[model samples]
Target: MHQIEKETVLDVRGLRTEFGLAECPLVAVDDVSFQVKAGEILGLVGESGSGKSITLRSILGIVRPRGRVWGEILWKGRDLVPLDEAALRRVRGREIAMIFQEPMSSLNPLLTVGLQISENLAAHTDLNSKERKARAIELLDMVGIPAARNRLGDYPHEFSGGMRQRVMIAIALASNPQLLLADEPTTALDVTIQDQILRLIQALSRDLGMAVILVTHDMGVVAETCDRVAVMYGGRLCETGLTADVIADARHPYSLGLLRSIPRDVAPRTPLYSIPGAPPSLNALPAGCAFTARCPVAGPECRDVRPSLETTGRQRQVACHHREEALIHFSAREAAQ
Candidate 1:
């Protein structure tokens, strides 16, 4: 959770993404803003359908045909939003790379893992075929794949779930991207394997000086791996702060609910906590706060006005009309305990 003072590698401002018909589009991400610094790991966390993945896809320029994305995505002070397809091609996989959630579906079943890595190299680099092959093997080895040379011809199905995820990481790193986008990279792995993958990613970020944006629903993962975190709900950021700060003192109710739900140090046989009700539908969101329906402290005013994300401290932000009251309540509860 250390905040590095390196240069900002990526700055996303007012990023809005929408999909569906031209007349009746649903906003998946709404005016979301965040920053990632060189060699820093930033986590985007929320429940499913909270726009975590959509925000990452928008930044990678991989949104679907019907999807519309707007706002500035600045990479090293250069705006990437308006870049044409060809220009984006040069940026994608080279300047920026993404490792998807499901490795089984992302990797090619027919192609050798080495071949896939070589393909990425072939597309983005000037390395000759021989050099590319050599680099591919090196990448596999770097990602801890056993018998890299012999596994060059192995298909996706030949590898286990954890190994497949490593292969995905190897491919993403083939281009030496400055920014890495990992969407639920550890979702399918067992607990032990998940720890390995997360540690590998954290180590890779430090060693390669690569900035990373990790999207996940696991609060434990974010707490253990990220320097900072952004909590999203209903297509908007509910809270953002240093990982330790937000986890220890969550200002937004949504963030507080998420932290409280985690089974940490509770007595044995105690029922697990959970946020009540479901997230609001993006297509038919209420005019007021999207979280009003599920918020325990929602008042009449909460149903009539949406609160913008406001700065609560030097390195914290939250969106809630009763932020002050919530802070006081949390403090009082902590004192009582």
Candidate 2:
């Protein structure tokens, strides 16, 4: 049986975000583009300073005042780039919501969890205080918080890290958003808790039919949770494709490097692979492919001319001058290992 195609909930095209002086601003996100369909989970994976978080902020029009954003962020066919705060507010939290990376910082220490959830209900829905309280308890229960009504009045600090993260998820779902932007939702948690949170998010996406853009640095998480993956480096996307395809046979050197770096079930005392060199500074990005310095297969052209993202196969795109060579070269090496 053929699966039905989902609606496109978000379409981002040529997204660029910058900060600093207009004359020589530092580019944080450069010409990044992707789409999210309803009931799909897209993983945005990269190392620190790869602009994955910045890309998410740009989509929601939440970049700071000093920052500038260009290109299009179409949410349900409506352009969000040009929308003012007033207009964006109508869509934010109600139609789309975000689960920030750190629940401790994102949640208010002064306010109770129930009040925070109710605040969203008050803003987006016409529910009265009595009804909002009821909804808040229901949300807490939905997120697996035990004694939901009893926990409503508890302050954020009173909860453990995992529980606080659950509260954040509950709050984000208060408005029952169609789209959810999760920024490292499992960060700073123990492995067991991380698995639990990831499972919860997956279940919520399935049950609610909510589209998700999950930002993280873990390839393992992407492999486990995402339907599709986008790999970023130096503020630009290097690869985008279905998760299984990208993981099985990465075409870009950067993507291959990331996959290789993941630890496997190997003999004891085996040295883990690590990608060489740190990412380039945003203020001093190269004119050509940003990964050229670290890329093993880089040529003169890779150092002098930038590579545009080009289609390599069905639903797969790569920005590389030697994508075909990389595929052949890496495949042979992996097979021989």
Off by over 4 Å in 2: 328-337
Please provide TM-scores, in order, for all candidate models, with all chains considered together. Answer: 0.95, 0.97
Candidate 2 positional error at 271, Å: 1.4
Name the weakest run of 10 consecutive residues (lDDT summed) in model 2. Answer: 328-337
User: What number of clashing residue pairs does each candidate have, in the order they appear?
Assistant: 0, 0
Which digits, one per residue and each the tens of the lDDT, describe model 2 over residues 1-337? 9989899999999999999999999999999999999999999999999999999889888996778999999999999999989999999999999999999999999999999999999999999999999999999999999999999999999999999999999999998999999999999999999999999999999999999999999999999999999999999999999999999988899899888888887669877778889999997789999999998789899988999999888799999999877777777866876
Displacement of residue 98 (Cα, Å) in model 2 is 0.5
After superposition, which runs of candidate 1 have C-alpha atoms over 4 Å from their true positions?
Answer: 1-4, 327-337
User: Candidate 1 lDDT (Cα, whole model)?
Assistant: 0.91
lDDT for residue 291 in candidate 1, whole number 0-100: 85
Worst 10 residues of 1 by lDDT: 328-337
